[model samples]
Target: MSAPLEGVRVIDLTHHLGGPLATMALAQLGADVVKVEPPEGDQWRAVDDVRGESRVFHAVNRGKRGVVLDLGTEEGRAALHRLVDGADVLVHSFAPGVAERLGAGAAELTGRNPRLVHCSLSAFGPGGRRGTDVALQSESGLVAANGGRVMPVPAHDTVAPWIMVSGILAALLERERSGRGQVVETSLLEASAALAAHRLIEEDSGEPLFNRFVGALYRTYRTADGAVALACYAPRLHARALTALGLGHLLDDPRFADLPSRARHSDELAVLIGERLAAEPSANWLTALDAAGLPHGEVADRPFSLLDHPDAAAIGLVVEVDDPTLGRERATGPPLRFSRTPPRPGGPAPRLGEHTAEVVGVSVGAGGGR
Candidate 1:
């Protein structure tokens, strides 16, 4: 069997993380994705988040060809329509009304290619009275929920891209039978709300229920030399973990008697676990946990190199991409695996406009476009 999207072509007009990462997901699944950048390159390329590292650009934009086009000109817009004629999918992350002004609006695009699955990622949904430039987390209400401090993870920037991937895939699936394409819309607002799906279905007690990580043996703890993240929820595993830690005596204690009481005294249990855990290094605890068949392991930080985490390769969680400019760098691999048509590693992230002539039939330098 061939890769799922082996013959698909994607036109990526998204700039920052969410949109590019979405297309990257498709590319990893075997789409011939071509990213279209403005003359100055994707705005993410200018992001200096890690101080001299191209974290935003190289990381999210890998496994795709790139072309530069100054859509401010008619020629550039013409080139886009040409690309759309042959594209199976078109994804963009432009702000409200911006795509229309640039002749890349959904109506214009579908007019050129009615069978195109147009997926759009936006900070807000499509039309609005007015728009303000804000961080995705703020727009998604994550900052308010986190007491006004913006978190870098699980917010719209990262989570929304996966939503885009799903939306695109669903649209593609629909096109299979309908013999037509339709618009797929996803936004940071929707993505953030998805993070709180439980709130939507649960009864409104009118009391805020957040920061619920108070259960015993179901959290991270510091060991003598490192930390261990333990999952002790299952009844069998709960007993096994306590026996492994030699803390079975805790069951007889009045304050920590049953599972309910143990949950109520999660703080005390944590302290007691910490007291014993402090007596040995994480390696020893890991050995004991493994021997006792308890589900636990040492907590690890981001690896600066593969040497920092020898187990990264062993687990198959990360894949290596030979970035043309950044050299060999590790990126997250495709999340899924197919039995017969398993995805293969894709090509490196392209240099800015490196494929302009080949993809668009013109040189970006011909117009002083980056």
Candidate 2:
């Protein structure tokens, strides 16, 4: 079957993680995405730690064409308008007012392309406040979720991008009926709040929803070898875990009778579970847990390499791509699967304005020179 978005064209003015990721998703689904960068290119390409090269840029920008347009100049604005005339969607990650300042505002772009699906991704609510990655992470309570410690990764940055995708897809679906494109907006703050919905509390009368573990069942236990994360919330699975681990005596214990009681005495229960789990290798515990149908996973100490994993291949998570600068490399493909038209991973990221002439149909040189 043909790809769902095979005929769709996207004019991507986004940069960095959140905005790039949204366009990346559409690109994966077979949209003809043209990334419009400035003269020097996306500032992210000069990320200091990358030493003048950006692997993160390549990772998120694969399977798309590229153009360098100086939106700061009239020529740049004219180029954008020309591209907009033939496009179906436009996405950006600038702050609320930055687009207008650059003359690429919603009103201006929409006037040029009325059927344009304009997507804006920000750190806060639309037109509310500007925020940085660290600030949004802290504001979203993700920092507090770790018990006041900073997260090792950009967790909020990871989630905010998908939120933008959600809005973009919804807008596209609506356009199928209305034949009119609308503005789609999403923020890191909104994504963070949605992710923490379960942990949010109405009234904190000493019961912060995520301050502590509810029970010993939902935690990691170190065995003779590595550790395993066991999260069996079902009562049957809870009983099965105890029985499988030869700790069935706790089933009759009054303190462990119910979920609330088990949570209240979680400290005591943790000690018992920990001691038993440490007696054997995590592999042995996994055998018993799998047999009893209790949810569990072995925690990895190193980055997960899927080269040797059969399951990763089975799920179609890995794909081979040829990068212009880096040569052939194994990259991650789309997460979601489709029976008719699955997402097909494509070639490497563009070289600056590699496809400027082909995409814009003009004799434009690389970067912003010509």
**Each model's lDDT:** 0.78, 0.80
Cα lDDT tens digits, model 1, 185-256, are: 888777777776765454567654433334678888888888898887675576668778889888789876
Each prediction's RMSD over C-alphas, in Å, is: 3.3, 2.6
The C-alpha TM-scores of every prediction are: 0.87, 0.92
Writing each residue's lDDT as its tens digit, candidate 2 over 127-219 gives: 778887778768777778689877776666777778877777888889989988988887888777877878665884766564444568888
Off by over 4 Å in 1: 48-55, 128-149, 152-154, 199-201, 204-214, 301-311, 364-370
State the RMSD for candidate 1.
3.3
Q: TM-score of predicted model 1?
A: 0.87
lDDT of 2: 0.80
